[model samples]
Target: MYKKETRGMDIHTFATDGNQEGVLAELEKGIFVDSRNEKGYTPLACAAKSPHASVDLLRLLIDAGANIHAKVGESQRQPLALAACSGSLEKVQVLLDAGADINAESPSGYTALLHIMFRLHDNEMLLPMAEFLVQHGAVMDCESQYRESPLSAAYLRRRWDVVRFLLDAGADPSPLRWSKLLEAVALGSCHDVKELLRVPGALQQRDRFSRTPWLLAAFVGHLDKARLIHAAGIDVNEIGQCGETALMTSASIGNPEMIKWLIGVKVDLELADEFGQTALTQAVQFGHADCVEILLAAGADPSITNEYGDKPITLTTSEEVVRVLVEAGEDIGDVSTEMRRILIGLEGSSTLRVSKSEYQEGCQRRFGSSNPETMDVPFWQEMIRTGIPAYESKSQFGDLYEMTCVWCFNRFGASFTALPDGRYVQIGGEHEDYYDPDFCIYNDVVVFQGDGNFTIYGYPQEVFPPTDFHSATLVGSDIYIIGGLGYHGSRRFGTTPVYRLNCHTWHMEPVTSTGACPGWIYKHKATLSEAGNITIRGGTIAIAQDGVEDHVENNEVFQLDLTCMTWTRFAAEP
Candidate 1:
């Protein structure tokens, strides 16, 4: 073992010292030239990495049958990659000439060129070594496992010269991958961006979220890049995926100069997002007093309200912003505040109340029943049994009282149906706004028996996710649930969403239907006819228009044939 260790170290030492004579002499003795040291450094790898090593030394090791592709250490460090890291063009050339793969990667997926660009920090020989590697057919866009290409790595390392060279060498700056144009805008580099603009459709590139390059400039307050992109034919008032204009983005970031630039460019300050938030509203909500003042001075309407009915003054908590809004002839008080006060006042006020027994008596009077247990059982069952009536829970005392098992009536867009065995079933629903913490889309089946007994059954998320605004029509023993709004991330766009719930076992299963299915519909009516057809009518369907989901009112009637489970759409008669 000791002899083997000594021989390995001798070859490695000779290789590291760049001693061509000693390495050749070792070859004459027929020694193992590919022997690895304790650091897993073979003779060829050591010689390739040594700066003092001549090209002949590398060639001698290669001629001696040393592995040119031999990798060492846990990183699987290749010999050619080590030579490239040394910034020696000749050593890199010797390895490449000796059948070394130019683009061979380590276990981490970094090629020899990527290693040189990423590891070198302002070295004088960086460009020459990079040029040498590139000239030899090194892939400029070969990405690492982290999706970072050679050009992107250089860009991230702030190597502008290398970035320009790589760009000139025809590296593709994919908008979906790491975007050089967006990065230049972020760095506020107009010169670099100007040079990059020569690429066709450079200014028109958008990220995955549909954020334009000009919009990114607005986000970072880079007026120079914004002007560059604008001059290059990019729209200054480009709207993002959420309908947010560049002016609104600048206002939200509290950049007064960016706001001033946007205003000077004649951007539409009144443009609102999907939430109806304008630039002034954005500034006020983020408490940017300076931005608010600038926007108002630029002829922005101070009275503009969002979809939530919140204007600048109503949304702003900043006293300075409020004063600015007031000086601009805006309303002084918040309407929401007055509404909140009214609700608070009602919270303390008392209403004429009745005892539970009196409420039961009133229920007995209404239903003509003598049993107290059966009286005022919150008659949700009776309403579904007959027809919905103008019914309120009140006793003969003319006041309301709480029931033993309080069924919350706060559900909206939920399914409530009467089962065949005299059981009432209530399906999934949400309370209020989807953004609210309490706004939960329930997937539980609330079963109300005829004997005033109720049970809540829950299914797995995969079986029944949070559902709402769908139709639950009873067809035989199975309840066929048609389309509704689920979570945005879980929405299936191309086909209709159908599920079946067995009333007997309460088991839920998804149904995959075919043939011209209604794509993502809600607020629709589903009816089971005697001919075993479920006809659907008058619902809003979510259709992807220009990559954005648009809800269009669908008046066409679609019938689902249960036998084959297919949908057939036909024109609805006026």
Candidate 2:
């Protein structure tokens, strides 16, 4: 019978303490050999994982009927897995000779061979263990519930030595499913990709999503794999779902190497997506300046527009991009035939039910009437950098020389509200002080008359309305302003106070109703629809410099009915 003194401290405790004779004595007393500690470790498990564990102690525990396959950790690692994880070759051999399950997996589905491969910091160590396991009936494939077999898993984990060993051992040379190849490319596994390509007919395989490995590789700018795929007899011009070709994807992701390589291979340059957006349009939209230059030099037609009537130049305001397209013989300020089709197709409530003939007349009236084109030297003038106008003419335009010049733009969040008659209102935003060289902030407005002059209209001196990221939409002579960040008493806050500037009346009015405003936010886009609904969409709340988050996520699309100036949430699904 077990001694009463030994009852207080169980066999697991003896194993954890490395008391081999005490553990053997307990086994002699017929104490339950598989008894556990609070950490779910059996006595044999404690002994095997102990830093002080002896090879003889492990052998004795197995000789005493300790379940060698008993899993004993949070991940339920078997004793042999633990031995492999600990890099203990002697303990591993001892368990194997005593008939330990060499192929046993942890709760996470990692086998002894996998743990050996996983624990490896040195490849030569893994080379021996991997070879030993294969000789002892460990399955070479070693597939796991995580959807990776031993070969792909080693490849995915970047274990090249194990990967090579597994490949030499005839690891199923296929990444047969979407998840396997998806992991390979998405995680940047270039080494194993060479072997993955050797799978029978691997080039024609598509994921469940019908995306080839080439497509996914392009999706993330994985240029090495893309180059490899192109060389491996797969066409670089292959189109995936949504008509996403490799060249278009290269432009979309802004990968210069992929763009250059695809161009060198003569991939289609003018191929548009499902939405009729070309690679040039994609490059311009995402502000890839170098790609835009390359496409232009490669003879890409920079004059093309998308289905939304946005030409390559319209997608970006970069001067470099504009110069590239213009140099390629694309006129800067002209509407192409594509945009004319879009304007001619506009009807119904979208066009506010205007008659087709009248709309067509307006379209002709508006297109290319006031393009800012340059003339010959000594008469040429161009808008450059800021609002500061430059003139190259020998004589100045008549009234422009007499107009007042006000420096109106160290300003952010200001609205440039355009009018039908070619005049515009520059509404309120904060500006740095004009007097103090260091500059203070204040709320103000300016009015531009488009003949090279503007008038500064300062707000009330008693109130400094330093609104942040506000939006101003023009409706007739009145400009509606709503939802922006504000500052007062050294604290920042979101403001919902709605206001209107009546230019015709020469006064400001508090446009108020209980439901007249979307909750306060910053950086939102506001537009005046023809139906008198002022639609507000997308902006984020401001936080303090130390980042104390005090806000709500404003995701609902709101429309303020301008007739009543009442706020209402509308469905954004179109």
Candidate 3:
């Protein structure tokens, strides 16, 4: 349904317009041999745009003596340059291997690689072809018609890896072109790009924009790169176009490491930006606490207010930060009494002293150090003898102590053995705290079996009387035992027997005479609140008839009020 052009435009035009096979057949017929289109495009130039331009077609065209140097349209771009620009690497290699000029200048006088890099900005293709052309003795220093070489093109595109490879391959990054260096620094190609300015005469040579390498690197926050240039004996604190030093740029970026390095290298920290803000002031305004700490530790004045009259402490929302500034002798006039109290509390407890042998052992254990010099043995003994004291003077919740086996020292589950001395022993999870007979101190609550055969003897007398499997809670000066299955012999005395123990004597109070109370259960969590209320959570509930078979869940919450001496059912939705 398409009309052919009536004019003398030959089959070369047909090849460019999707009649590749028809044109090749006509060319083989030798009728339109060496025919030219109106635009002077050869059959090869037309076939370059065809999707079906196979290797056989290309070879046939070349054998028919087709002009490989042909250009399409007014652009006058060579087929090789067109292939490179189009990213057709196969077509490019085909044309190049077929005696197409590798370094043939385009209509714009740009070599294929330079044109590709400039137009497509593809480093993947540009780098390989550029290297290939250059390795094949394509001119490295040859300037394009636009006065830009491949090096300048790579630099402009910020392809640092390609730029580095190109430069090492003897591509001259002309120092006179200041845009190349500026572009390199702007694009973070500072690592090797700055080396271009380090060439013997390039440092002294100014760019076209009249900016030096030091100025450009500083402007772009390439401090490490700038430091490299500085190590070459250039001024570390060199002022740029706006009188901005490298230190000021680092301060603006809040890079503490770079600032520390600059200060160590003797770059003046006192140097201010155009707004008269020093590095110390910048750190405070940005609320970089570690940087502020570093600056203050290096003798930066925290008292110096910024333009808004806000000191370093005022900029921080952290209490520890304010305390740190105040401890550094920063004058914070007449702070709140509560703030003063909090700050005083922040002074922390005194360092605990330990013997040298224990300290070395502690250090060795903590740091995993085999070296004796790094170990502190005395610290370990003190840590073991007296664990850190409890924060409160009195444990309000009534103390809970864990007891383990002396040999195995394992934690006790529901199954554990009671020794003849009335001491409970567990297997596995043995620790030092388990062996301490004085584990439960004054007012500490201890749970024991309700069987009347066992007695816990402290120093002078029995601490807790003989009891069976029953739950107890410790209040101010008394131990209250609640309902449980009382033990006589091997028989279960299922009764709700309540007992109260004072410092003088233990007395039993019968709460309820209900027959066959719930069976004895252990390993239950007992909690005592501040309002004289007791809660027993999560334990087995069982009713003993003749044999202990119907043991249901005691997952329900139970509460006892010591003031009223009455039990209340907690209405928690199950």
Best model per TM-score: 2
Cα lDDT for residue 136, candidate 3 = 62
Query: Against the hidden true structure, what lDDT does model 1 obtain?
Result: 0.72
In order, what is each prediction's RMSD in angstroms? 23.7, 24.2, 28.7
What tens digits encode model 1's per-residue C-alpha lDDT throughout 431-493? 556654334566767666745446556566766777888988888999899998887767777
* Model 2 lDDT tens row, 1-574: 1122334247877786778888988888878787766677778788777767788889888888889888776778888877766667788899888888888887677888777666664545666777777877888776668765666655544455666677677777566345455547655478867778777777777753456888767775788888777778877778887787888878876888888888998898998888888889888877788999888788888868788866686666555665576567543333232221222231112112224343223211011111111111111111111222211110123323422222223344555554556455555443343343322233455454545444544445333354546777777787777766655353334336577776665355567745635565666767666788887877765444456656555676888887876777665721
Q: Name every residue pair that clashes in candidate 1.
A: none
| Model 3: per-residue Cα lDDT over 1-574, one tens digit each | 1223344365766666656577667766664444556665656776765555654566667777777886555667677776666556677778878888877886677777777677667447677767666776677776776687777676555466677777788777663365544555545465666666556754443444344666556544566666666666776766653456766655555677877877787877676655556666666555566676777777767666555655555555445555467568553322322233233232223343544343333332121111111222344223222323321101211222312111110111211222233322111111223235322111112222323111221221132222333455556555556543222232233333455644223222334423223335433445567788766665665456575445556656666666766555554621
Between the candidate structures 1 and 2, which one is better when assessed by lDDT?
Answer: 1
Against the reference, the lDDT scores of all candidates come to 0.72, 0.63, 0.52
The candidate, 1 or 3, that scores higher on lDDT is 1
Which residue runs does candidate 3 get wrong by more than 4 Å? 1-20, 28-40, 49-52, 175-574
TM-score each candidate: 0.35, 0.36, 0.33
Name the lDDT value of residue 274 in candidate 3: 57
Ranking by TM-score: 2, 1, 3
* Candidate 1 error regions (>4 Å): 1-6, 175-574
